[model samples]
Target chain A: DQQVKQNSPSLSVQEGRISILNCDYTNSMFDYFLWYKKYPAEGPTFLISISSIKDKNEDGRFTVFLNKSAKHLSLHIVPSQPGDSAVYFCAASARVVTGANNLFFGTGTRLTVIP
Target chain B: EAGVTQFPSHSVIEKGQTVTLRCDPISGHDNLYWYRRVMGKEIKFLLHFVKESKQDESGMPNNRFLAERTGGTYSTLKVQPAELEDSGVYFCASSPGTSGAGEQYFGPGTRLTVT
Candidate 1:
C-alpha cells in the first residue's frame, strides 16, 4: 500500500488566487514532511517543510500545514503566479528509521496557475 | 554550489538490455539516496547510502537492480536485463549528515524507457 498519497492529480487556479494542494499518509511513524516543486524536464526543488511539532510553517508565498493526528498535510500558495505552475510532491520520513532516512513521496499534484 | 546532478537525461533500451544510471551529490554531503517514479505511480525509494556503505536497500524491487556508492563520492545504479516495467524517472537526492528534519535536495531525474 502507498504510505503517502495525493488524491488530486491536477489542480488549476487563476493568477492572484490561492492554490492549495493536499496529501495524506497511512504511516504514523512519519514525523517530518516536505514539499517539492518540479518543472518539466527538471528535478524537484525543495519548497517547504514542517516538523510534527508544528502545525504550520510558512515561507514567503508558500505555506505548509501539517495535521499529525489526521495523517494529512496541505501546501498553500498565496497570490499564485503563472510561474508557480508545476508539479508538487509531498514527502514524509520515518523518525525512527536511521541511516535509512529515505522519504516516501506522493504521486504528485500538477498545479496550473493561469494568467 | 552545484546541486545534485544525474547523467544521461534520457535513455531508451529494449527489454532484456542493461542500463546504468549515475548520480553525483553535492560536495561534502554524506548521505545519498536513490528514488524512482514509474508511470502513474508515486516516487519510491530504492536505497540510501551513508558514505560508501549502504544503509538500507529494502525498497529495491528485485535482484536485477544493483546500487553502489564507492569511495563515498559518486553513485551508480545498474539494472540488468531490464523489463518494460522498469521504465520511469530515477531521482537522486542528498542531505547533510546532521539534518534531523530530513530535508533532501533532489537532482534532475534520469528518464529510463525500456521498450
Candidate 2:
C-alpha cells in the first residue's frame, strides 16, 4: 500500500509565478514531512521540511504547509525559476515511533517551468 | 566535505548473475539508509544502519538481497541470482545525528538492470 501519494504526475508553471505541488498520506502516524528536489541524472536533494506540530514552514522561496487533520501537505515555490524545473518528491516519517527513522516517499511530481 | 558516494552508476546484469553495489557515506555521519525506486513507483526503504549495527530491515524484499556495513564507514548491498523484478535505482542516504531530526543527504543512485 502507498502511504504517501502525489496525485499529480506532472505540473507546469510560468517563470516568476507560484508553483504549488500537493501530496497526501493515509498514515496518521507520520509526524515529520520533507520535500526533495531531483534533477535528471542526479540524486534527490533535500529542500524543506515541516513537523506535525507546525502548520507551515518556510525557506527562502520555498514554503511547505501541512494540515495534520487532513493528512495533506503542499509545497509552494514563489517566483519559480527555470532552475526549479525538476522532479519533486514528498516524504514522511514517524520518527518518534520508529528507531530506524526510515522515510516513506511519494511517486514524485515532475515540474516544468516555462520561460 | 564530500557527500555520499555510490559506485557503479549503472549496471546491467543477466538473470542468475550476482551484483554488488557500494555506498560511501559522508564522513562523521553515523546514519545510513538504503532505498530503491522501481519504474514509475515511489522510493521504498530497504534498510537502515546506525554505525555498524542494523537498526531496521523490515523493508527488505527477500533473501536474495544482502546488506552489510562492516566497519561503519561504508556499506554494500548484494543481490544474488538477480531477477527481472529486482531492477531499479538504488539510493543511499546519510545523516549526521543519532536522532531522526537531521536532513538526509543522498548520493547519485546506482541503476541496476536485470535482463
Top candidate (DockQ): 1
| Stretches of candidate 1 exceeding 4 Å from the true structure | A96-99
lDDT of 2 at A18: 99
TM-scores of all candidate predictions against the true structure = 0.97, 0.98
| lDDT score of residue B67 within candidate 1 | 98
Per-residue lDDT of B75 in model 2: 99
lDDT of 1 at A96: 60
Compose the digit string of candidate 1's lDDT tens values, residues B1-115. Answer: 9999999899999999999999999999999999999987898999999999998999999999999999999999999989999999999999888886678989999999999
lDDT, each prediction: 0.93, 0.94
Candidate 1 chain A TM-score vs. reference chain A:
0.96
TM-score of candidate 2 chain B vs. the reference = 0.96
lDDT (Cα, tens digit) per residue for candidate 2, span B1-115: 8999999999999999999999999999999999999998999999999999999999999999999999999999999989999999999999986644657999999999999
Clashing pairs in 2: none
> What's the lDDT of the predicted structure labeled candidate 1?
0.93
What is the lDDT for B72 in model 1? 98
TM-score of every candidate's chain A: 0.96, 0.98
Candidate 2's residue-wise lDDT over A1-115, tens digit each? 9999999999999999999999999998998999999998788999999989899999999999999989999999998999999999999998866644899999999999999
